[model samples]
Target: MSMVEVQPGGASGMTMPAAPKRRTLPGWAIFVIGVVGVVGVLATTSYLTGEAALTSSSTMQNTVTLGMPILLAGLGGIWAERSGMINIGLEGMMILGTWGAAWGGLHGGPWVAVLSGAVFGALGGVLHAIATVTFGVNHIVSGVAINLLGAGIAKYLSTLIFAPLSSNPRDSPPIERFDTFSAQPLADWLGELEQDQRAVISDVAGLLRGLVTRVSPMLLITILLVVGTYLLLWHTRFGLRLRSCGENPVAAESLGVNVYLHKYVAVIVSGALAGIGGAALVLGSSPSIYSEGQTANRGFIGLAAMIFGNWRPGGTLAGAGLFGYADGLRLSAGPQTVHALLYAAVIAAGLVVIWQLWRRKWTTATLAAVGAVAVYALYYASDELPREFLPYTPHIITLVVLALAAQRLRPPAADGLPYRRGEGD
Candidate 1:
């Protein structure tokens, strides 16, 4: 109605009106959204499954404790592979770490336990280094030897050290655990949400409380190690050279990078990390005893996580979290929880189908739809899942995901290849 503004264009005096700028989401926002989405799915699943109790602060704390070892082992694998070595002996190394921790605890308490575990792990690394790096033994064979040696040594040491003390050759005496610390006020504030109807919020609050308060020293160290490893691998001169050895050791050696020395260092660090993980496992558990098969194939799972993560630290962490979540779910499974989880799976599948369709991926969308339908049918057909089968859920997920994503997965180019001083790949 304003005749004074006769111009067709706006204040800019352009022929065409300017399009509104898109409010693009920042990277951090996107990441947060993704996290929230995942959390929401988990929370809903828990609530529907009547497993909401599993999402409490205490459970989350337990999850982190259980997940820490897996994370460490995965990191160890990353270190070895990134330097052109394959460490299949992580399980053996971890076993040594456990014995070391027990020995240390017996002698000097918690601090000594950590150091002893590290030392023992380093010893294992030394043997591996000698076999693979110095003697040119096949990496897998060397690892297997280390595993056999570690298990035998642990059992022998148990008899010599712990058997007399505990009267048991298969297990060691209980060790003191590190003190758990938490902010009382914060914990109290978060604890109030324990009974919240919104399961997601309640779960988040519980996790926050556990993480912020009642955290153990070992947990802090584990987190620090993760950050430190990232910096060491990506931001340091030595790290670059070490990574180069894994990529092309021949070229690296030509460029004056001591391939053998770096390989030795890498394997040593790998063992150290694995040792820390083993110590964490002992320290995090009840009675804190080192027993036979205590590691329970966590090392293999770590290897699987490494593969799932595409050999990156961040990716490895994510993979470990997923596996840990599955483990947690299994541990806390109930009739309600299982039912909720089943429904949650169907809903998740439906969301996947919708997401694919939104992206205009017809085939993918159709597949997702079919998958969703299949999940629903499976849930409908089965009245209930056996409780015993719950323990294998994580492993089953790992196998399925790997099978589906194996084609796109890539490892360091020379990850398992032998690097002679003058050889070419």
Candidate 2:
């Protein structure tokens, strides 16, 4: 399913920062929980399946690959929302990024691919901005247009651009992807510990060893974006005004905040970030972009991450991590029927469990995060967990969750509102 943003107003007023003052879980707790959760799940699976001979490094590497793009996409969406614009074109931008990177990397260099993607991403954003910011077109309609354009272009161009697998040259790289490191040492023993769990523990451990999850520099870049965006949205003067425009454009215009400019910048920056996410995905994942319907529904997933984070960069980062981890588990485990169902249960139960724990303050975000992983581990071990519904069910659930969250939270009054010169205010 898609993770679209649901508008939850700022804690109080526009000036009131949306970032929470106290985390139920400390940063360290989150780190520890993530570590424990990953290791525990990997170990249990390895032992149960007797695939323990595989190295832990490889599994971790794979996990990082899956999570990195999700992280960036989520945060990129947050950046746009911070300034009061809703960019629903993340998937479109992602395709542009993918296509641009593939072409640039092949014809130019890897760095050229990255740069070209960024430029094209900005171009896509410009297309969106012209309609929504300058011409006062509906933001949703503009986004839909962008998505359609991206789909059409990707479909028509994939065959034209990509080299034939049967090319005369045998040893050439097909698409340009960046290689950051040799396998990290931490991956080996990270999930190898033996625990005393009775049912299917060994199978979990073996799977972890066999998995080859790569750690990307992109993860570090994503972290920086979170911190940097947090500072920009909450600490900077421009951020305050930008956010104000999103919440109430009339009030901002009354105060001379230039509503059109804010929307333009916000949307454009959103495009840039989304483009970066695409580049990271191509460089980090498999070579080149998907041919047709390549982006699938990630644009929607990104929107969900933005809403889940309340437009805060830090929260968005954590939210992205949650998604990334969930996606990685599928690769880490064996049968789709088994792991996918387990993942769905974790996703389904996640918000409920967090809300339950949150009601009593007994559940910290880290705990919620950890509990989510724990649920997946349990679901993975059992065959009776409704395997068939697992793979595709999460998509429907995600849409419902986002829509419901939208009901609970009021989006920026100007979410789909366009910005114009004299009339916008």
Q: Highest lDDT: which candidate?
A: 1
Per-residue accuracy of model 1 over 190-218 as CA lDDT, tens digit each: 88886665657887886677577678889
Error of 2 at 250 (Å): 2.1
User: For each predicted model, how many residue pairs clash, with residues at least 3 apart or on different chains?
Assistant: 8, 44
Candidate with the greatest TM-score versus the true structure: 1
Cα lDDT of model 2 by residue, 1-425, tens digit: 32334445544332323454554786557656755654555444444444432223343455466555656667667667655666788778877876776667777766776777676677788898887776767777878888888766655566554536423221124565555553445335534442333344433543443343343456666668767877887789888898888777778888888877877787777777777776766776554543444455766777776776566655455555555544554455445323443454465456556666767655455565776788777865665434454454435545654654564455566666555556642
lDDT of 2 at 290: 35
Per-residue error for 274 in candidate 2, Å, reads: 1.5
Worst 10 residues of 1 by lDDT: 1-10
Global lDDT of each candidate:
0.82, 0.61
